[model samples]
Target: MVRTRLINHPLVVGLLEIAAGEIGYEHRGMIRVLCDVEQFRQTIDLVVEGD
Candidate 1:
């Protein structure tokens, strides 16, 4: 996926729409868990560095 300052770009909007539709709801939970794990890892790294 590409990020653009132009939120209304037709091609990017279309591509995101198609991608969103293709990702099933069943996989959302897994994605959320992965994101949570990433956040946790970052938090741990920050704590370690503070020592």
Candidate 2:
């Protein structure tokens, strides 16, 4: 999934660490992003923009 790809990036990993306690994996390699939706979106946006 998108998160799996994002997780490969150091920048995204650092940003995700802010909410690491809340983030987890679900069944079949799916990730559960339980942090602020806006913040998560921004993280993805930052990584995508960087690419």
Candidate 3:
């Protein structure tokens, strides 16, 4: 996976934290986050999937 610099953005970091907390310990680092302006709805879905 090509880790993007966007990973450091506050919004991305906040989303990642929420995802990590929701998924819990076992699946901590297994999830992947992607962003696409053309697919706004789907991107939001991915962000909240852990919940």
| Leading candidate by TM-score | 2
Quality of model 2 by C-alpha lDDT: 0.66
User: How do the predictions measure up, each by TM-score?
Assistant: 0.35, 0.55, 0.45
* Candidate 2 lDDT by residue in tens digits, 1-51: 364666878867665565465553333453455567787788788889988
lDDT of 3 at 32: 47
By lDDT, the candidates rank as 2, 3, 1
Please write out the lDDT profile of model 3 over residues 1-51, one tens digit for every residue. 324654665556766677667665466445644444545454444545634
In order, the Cα lDDT scores of the candidates are: 0.44, 0.66, 0.54
> Total clashes, candidate 2?
0
On lDDT, the stronger of 1 and 3 is 3
Q: Pick by lDDT: which candidate is best? A: 2
C-alpha lDDT of residue 37 in model 1 = 49
Considering TM-score, which of the candidate structures 1 and 2 is the better prediction for this target? 2
Worst 10 residues of 1 by lDDT: 28-37
- Worst ten in a row by lDDT for model 2: 22-31
Cα error of candidate 3 at position 26, Å: 4.0
